[model samples]
Target: MAKQQLAVLITLLAFLGPAACQQQGLHICFNGWLKVPPLLSYLLCPPGSRTTNPPPSPSPNPAPPSGAGLSYDYYNNNGSSSYCPSAESLVKDAVKKAIDMDPGVGAGLIRLFFHDCFVRGCDASVLLNTTTSKDSPTDTEREGPPNKNSLRGFEVIDAAKAAIEATCPGTVSCADIVAFAARDASSLLSYGKINMKMPGGRLDGRVSFANETDQLPGPFSSLAQLQSSFREKGLSSDEMVTLSGAHSIGKAHCGFFSDRLPPNPSTMDYAFATELEVKCQGNEANMVHQDYQTAYVLDNKFYQNVRANKVLFDSDDVLKTVREVKQNAEYPEIWERKFEKAMENLGRIVDVKSRREGEIRETCWRVNGAGY
Candidate 1:
């Protein structure tokens, strides 16, 4: 009887031990699997079952796709960096020659630069860099932002570049090209030096700004508003009036200032306001598009126009309110000196990186996706 009882006890121990081992083995196996969950599996699986290890996230995303319609490869593609000074002079001369042949860009490009610099020194920061902000529009085709009626300036630059390339290839930096273009372009009217300092290597901006539209002085703004806007950019009242030299080339659509008519009219010079009302026919469609002349000529005319109450924009005409009487023939003479000095000062604004502070974007309306 004792032997039989001992045998049964050993058999029972063997059966119970195997069953406990099996249960613990399953728990250990599950724990190991939980330690390495696959990415998608972790997301899809219930809280308890997913493995922890995600296959090394596919090597971080490759660079953004080109032809994304969002980027402009100004420096790396389409042209070389600025050439030697001899080459630069060639480029500058070439651009001048082309502008001599063409109607638009040379004058427009110079005027655009002057417009930007005069307000805040020669800091091309005024040019939009859409690369990071994602604020620029796309340019997959010719229908890009430059074609927009609002961004006519980009079209002007494009024309100038095409003209320059035709005459001087790979000889100049776009920055220098633009600077010279501005000087020569402005010189077209007055036959006088623009009194410009070449801030070479000003990389064109990657994008145009829709937001800046609101910030830019409009055809109509209260004197106070105009002063505030100009002041924000470190310009004074006289300087604000002087900067209107931009009007020398650009055309104003009649509709741009139609609101200044009778009933709800914003205050403007009587003679100037009356002429616009008559010419615009209270409809923007009737306004004329006028070509801009040289800065020296442009500045002198703006002062004279304001004096005559022939200013076009509301803000322009209102210049008389502050020191209208002070702006006589003497004002124009003084204006020329100040204007030239301002132009020189404007081109000197630079950035810490020394990368021209911006890029000369192929598409002015958009930025390169690589955040160029």
Candidate 2:
């Protein structure tokens, strides 16, 4: 009698579409229905819903499983509204003012955030200056080959940090300030098209190393390599492709992709290759727009170009062949929605509590105690 009732429930769920199943808060959670008891189904998911996978358990007060001591309320000051609002507004206003003076600064801020996050989990380590002798081979992450002469927008972050320190003293961390600046820049550069609410309270990392940048994916990175890099940071392949849309704005130094040109042409379009060759003229220092069409706008045209085989970097081109990205390439709405969510998640990658293994740097360039 119990078996018959379970079979009836399964058949009813099958008849109900995913919409109905979701409305009833029920999920299938397994393939072999007979292996799962009927009571288990009710516990896993509510009735009238069918799903192939179990829903993620909610953690109302989650802590970082890695013991990094990060939390959503790491910066909370017991219902003190003044703490976050003042810092957030100051960072946004500073970034907006900077971008207004030079629109290109927006792309620089986005890239700066990536360079910082990819190396040392977005702790504003990239903003650190070389403390040792200038001629030394090993300096800071900012001086590394992957970053030197390539990364920009340090001054913008510096400006925002200075402004914030004036109002809030050492209450706001430079890491959080950098994150907020990047979010503001993204929204402003896209002309308010790609706005995302960023969570703050990240503590500043004290250590910065040039060698750690080996984790960063280069322009020549294969799809597998890019996926592996992002996966290590708790991001999915879909998110990797979504974040690559940032190429929609920014310029790349010609040296980064010159190897892809001429007799050994890679995935780049021939006409586009010829144009880049003319623009760059074999100069390593010369720069070209990552997306010539709508180069200053943050949009899905980057993916469209990738699909058409017109993007500059091999890494950007390969995103089109990824199954999940390929399907979403044509739908701007879908990609934009996914990209926003991914960006939000990316912002959380380095959210460490100030109380543990971190500090709120009085200045972005050096640790709080270390003298400039």
lDDT for each candidate structure = 0.45, 0.70
Question: Which regions of candidate 2 fall more than 4 Å away from where they truly are?
Answer: 1-84, 131-138, 263-266, 351-355
Residue 200: error of model 1 in Å? 1.9
The 10-residue segment with the lowest total lDDT in model 1 = 63-72
TM-score of each: 0.57, 0.76
- Per-residue lDDT, model 1, residue 69, is 16
| Candidate 2 C-alpha lDDT tens digits along 157-219 | 788888877877878888777777888888887777777866776677777766556567767
Q: Given candidate 1, what's the lDDT at residue 190?
A: 47
Name the best candidate (by TM-score): 2
* lDDT tens per residue, model 1, 117-153: 4322333333433445444444221222211243334
Who wins the lDDT comparison?
A: 2
Q: Model 2 lDDT vs. the true structure?
A: 0.70
